[model samples]
Target: MIIILLILSVIIGVFLGKYFGKSQSFAKNLLILSAGFLITVCVSEVFPEVYEAEDHNIGIWIIGGVLLQMILESLTKGFEHGHFHHHHEEKNILPIALMAGMFVHAFLEGIPLANITDVTSPYLLGIVFHNLPISFILGTFLLREKNNIFSWFIITLFALASPLGMVFGDYFNPEWQPYFLALVGGIFLHISSVIIFESNKNHKMDWQKLFLVIAGVGLALVNHLFHAHH
Candidate 1:
């Protein structure tokens, strides 16, 4: 069920981006909203879970995740954050580097999902929602470059990257679970924070964007509380 949802989200993202990627504002708004939810879940839930493990070197692993994302972004041109601009539409060939970056990032996201196995786990939710916009942008990029059967084959492979990570995640040493969680948490932080803080030039969010952010944070709180109670 979770694998289906994960694949469906990216497929849906491709559909939306192919048709509606021109509306950059909607994409940005989605990023803001998901960013709000993702960062909150990271701080309020995943971070706590990792720190509870009491690993002295955990902080460095998280930092490594952050750094890893930075490197991936260089390859993706910020596709993971839904920040792909309109200026690059002229190039009509598939970008292999972009696909590679998102593939690895998504793969890493799946690793921690296996550790904290839950249908409504924030880790899973974050990756699913977070992938939406990036996949959307990827679709848009495909639309601009090569909206061919071959392109969708690439998308299908990209869609499977996360679930594949989850499948392989079981092979990881059980003791290392917390470290993986912290690492993915850091990746979530960097992606979502860039979306929120860099959305506006002056860094001032309007009422609507502000509300989207608040709603996302509230969502994380509710999810956190529900898990706590159950």
Candidate 2:
């Protein structure tokens, strides 16, 4: 059942991303929604439990993970921006580097899913929601570069990356789980924060955009609250 849900979520993410790619406004909205949802997931779902576990030096791992992503982004020259491929002309190394970093990040995220004792469904749902916008962003980039085959392959790989991580995580010792969780959480924070920050229109704040972010967070809160009460 869990495996099925994972596959379904990835499929949903791919299609939604493809659909949203056609509209800038809708894509922006989706990103904001994803941001809110990610923030909520981090705060309400991931943070509390991860902090409590305190199984490993999370702070350090988080910083390390963020640094890793920063380096990767620099190499990729902001491939996450979507629809912009001028950087692609610079070198082939950038795309390969970006994929490596993103793959590692996605796989680590899957590790936590395997660790989830309760609320597995909700967690997977949130992950799917989060990945959809990212998939769209990546897809847009691929389309712009006219690399259809590579784009599809990258998208498919992104979807499966997490599940693969979960498999690896399942074999890891319980004592080391906290460190992994913190690292993955940090990676998520970096990605989601970038999404929100980049999604901002101009340097000025937009109420509608802010609202979408809040809506995303609210969705996660609702799920968290339900879990808490239960």
Candidate 3:
């Protein structure tokens, strides 16, 4: 289901970008909210689970993941935080470096899902939903750069990255799940924090964006509660 949803998200994103022109404002708000959702899931679910191991001191690994994302952003140029710098009039060549960074992040995020107790889980939902806005971002970027077979090829590769990570992770040892979860938690922490903080210029807060962020956090909380009861 998770893999299916991820692929569907890519298709939906392509449709959206095709019918509608570039949606910068909508994409920005979506990015903000997506960041909020990710942070909430990391705090409310992932952190607690990874910290459960008695012998596992995952602090270093978490920090390492954070640093890794920082380096990735250097290559992606903050696309993970919805900072799409390219305009429609830019060159028609693909941004291989940026996509490479995003693929790495998406792939790593799927690792823990393969070993999760609840196959249908909030973490899975968080990742799927989080990818929603990202898919839009990718669609816009790719279509603008190369609206051809090459662009679809890149998009297909992006869609497959997480599912491929799940396949790899399923064969990985179960004992390592906690450490990988912590690493992913740290990666989420970094991405979400960047989206929230670096979004508005001059630190000016828009009330609508603020409300969206709040709504994102609220939705995650409700999802967590609902899952806990079930």
Candidate 4:
């Protein structure tokens, strides 16, 4: 069901990109909300889980994840955070590097999903919602490039990347779960922190955007509460 939801999000994003290309505000708000949600979940849920592990070296692993994402973004030009800038002349060329980076990032996010001993729904939900804007942004870029077959194929691959990651993650021995979770925590930290920090370029915080952040955090809190009572 999680795999199906992830794929469905990408499909929805592609559909929106094709038909609603002009809806930049919607896309922007979606990115903001999703980023906020991811950040909140990472702090309120994911980080605490990994930190509680017996391994004292988990912090180093999480930092490693952050640094890894930084390198990946160098190739992707920050695609995971909605940085889909492209030159008009270069638009004719496929963004092979960007796609490769996004695939690795997406695949790593699924590693923690395979060993969901506690409060895994938030992780799954966070990634699925997070992927929507990513797919939308990528879909818009691909459609603009005018390669119909290739665009569809790449989007399909992006949709499947997480599910494939889950399959691969299932093969890991249980002992390594903490390292993988901490790594994912770090990845989430970098992505979500970047999104929140870079959300406002004018240096003045937009009230609407702030609300989105609050709403995102509220969502994570609500989910935590709901699960805690049950």
Candidate 5:
């Protein structure tokens, strides 16, 4: 059921982009909102749980995840965020590196899901939220490229990557889940921080972006408080 939701989230995003991909600002706003929710979850939930569970140096894995994401971003060219479009316009060739990076990133995110207790897990919600804008942009990219065979193939793999990771995690050693969570937490941190702090063209802070970010954080906290008591 969770696996299906993950795939459906991507599918929904892709269709949304297909029909309404004109507004770059709106997409960025969504990204900001998602980032705010994501980082709050990480700081408020994931990091604390991992640290509480283990006394050893999980920071190593967290730092490793951050570096891994950096490498992946080099390949993805920031498509995981809002830096989409025109990347392949001139070449019109397949972006194998981008796909590879995206696939691995999504897959890693799902691996930790195998250990999560329920659908309400913040990690689960965070991925579902983050993947929407990503796949939406991918849909827009496909439209720009005329929606060829490669586009379908790309979409399929991207959609399946996280679910497959969850399956893989089901077989993975249970004890190691914390370390992997730490790793993913780091990846989330980097992605969200970059989105929130990366300035606009004039290098000035946009008040609207700031407000949406605050709203995202507030929503996450409210949800957290609600779940804590209920």
Candidate 6:
């Protein structure tokens, strides 16, 4: 079931990428929605469980994951945004490196999803939903750069990274699960915060975008309520 969910997520990501690659506004809105949903998942769901587990030592893992992501992002110089227009010759090395970093993050996230006993459904749903927008944004960048084959390949690979993590998590003992969740939660928190901060309009406030964010949170809240009722 988990594997099937992951596969469905990848397919949905591909379809969303292909569909939204044309509209910058739609893409931006999708990203905002994804950011809100991800934040809710991390804060309302994942963090609570980690805290309940009483693993203060996991803070080290979270900090390490955040620092690792910072270093990786520094190497890419924000290429994940796909706005680079340098006349200097483009090399595939940096892009490949960025993908590797993302893959590591995604793979780690999958571990917790696989090990989840109580929160499995919502966690998996959040992951699948959140990944779709990321895939779309990355796809948009690739399309703009005119790298069709590489774009598809990277998107597909990103989709698979989580499931691979699940496989690892399934094989591993339960004792290490808290550390894994903390690490991935930290990474997700970092990524979602960056997206929200970057998406802020510097010159003026965008009410529509704000509303979209609220809508995203509302959706998650509603889902949470439904799950609770069930």
Best-fitting candidate, scored by lDDT: 5
lDDT of 4 by residue, 195-217 (tens): 77874666886889889878888
Give a tens-digit lDDT track for model 3, residues 26-87: 88888788888889999999988888875466878889889999988887777677766563
Tens digit of per-residue lDDT, candidate 2, span 1-230:
55556656666655655655557666667767977787677766666667887545667887877787677666556544343334445555455766776687677678877776553445666777777766666665555446578777776777788888888878988777767766766766776787677744567888887888888888887877777776
Worst 10-residue lDDT window for candidate 4 reads 85-94
- Candidate 3: what lDDT? 0.80
Model 5 regions lying over 4 Å from their true place? 90-94
lDDT of 5 by residue, 1-230 (tens): 89888999999988888788877776788889999999999998889888986658889888998999999988888888788756656554247987899999999999989987677776788899899989888888775447888888888999999999999999989988888899999999999999998867798778898898999899788877766776
Residue 98 lDDT in candidate 4? 68
Model 4 spans > 4 angstroms off: 85-94, 117-120, 144-147, 199-201
Indicate the worst ten consecutive residues by lDDT in candidate 5: 85-94
How many residue pairs clash in all the candidates, one count each? 0, 4, 0, 0, 0, 0
**Model 1 spans > 4 angstroms off:** 90-94, 202-205
Error of 1 at 125 (Å): 0.7
Model 6 C-alpha lDDT per residue in residues 1-230, reported as the tens digit of each score: 77777767766755665666667667667767877777787777777777777866767877776777677666445433333334113654466776786687678779876676544456777787677766666655565456577777877778789888988888888877778777777776776677676655575778886787788788777777777787
Flag regions of model 2 displaced more than 4 Å. Answer: 79-94, 117-122, 143-148, 198-202
Question: Candidates 1 and 6: which is better by lDDT?
Answer: 1
The TM-score, computed over Cα atoms with residue i paired to residue i, of candidate 3 is 0.91
| Displacement of the residue 5 alpha carbon in candidate 5, Å | 1.1
User: In terms of TM-score, which candidate is strongest?
Assistant: 5
The C-alpha local distance difference test score for the whole of candidate 5 amounts to: 0.86
Please list the C-alpha lDDT of all candidates, in the order they appear: 0.83, 0.68, 0.80, 0.80, 0.86, 0.69
On a 0 to 1 TM-score scale, where does candidate 2 land against the true structure?
Answer: 0.82
State, as a TM-score between 0 and 1, how close model 1 is to the true structure. 0.93
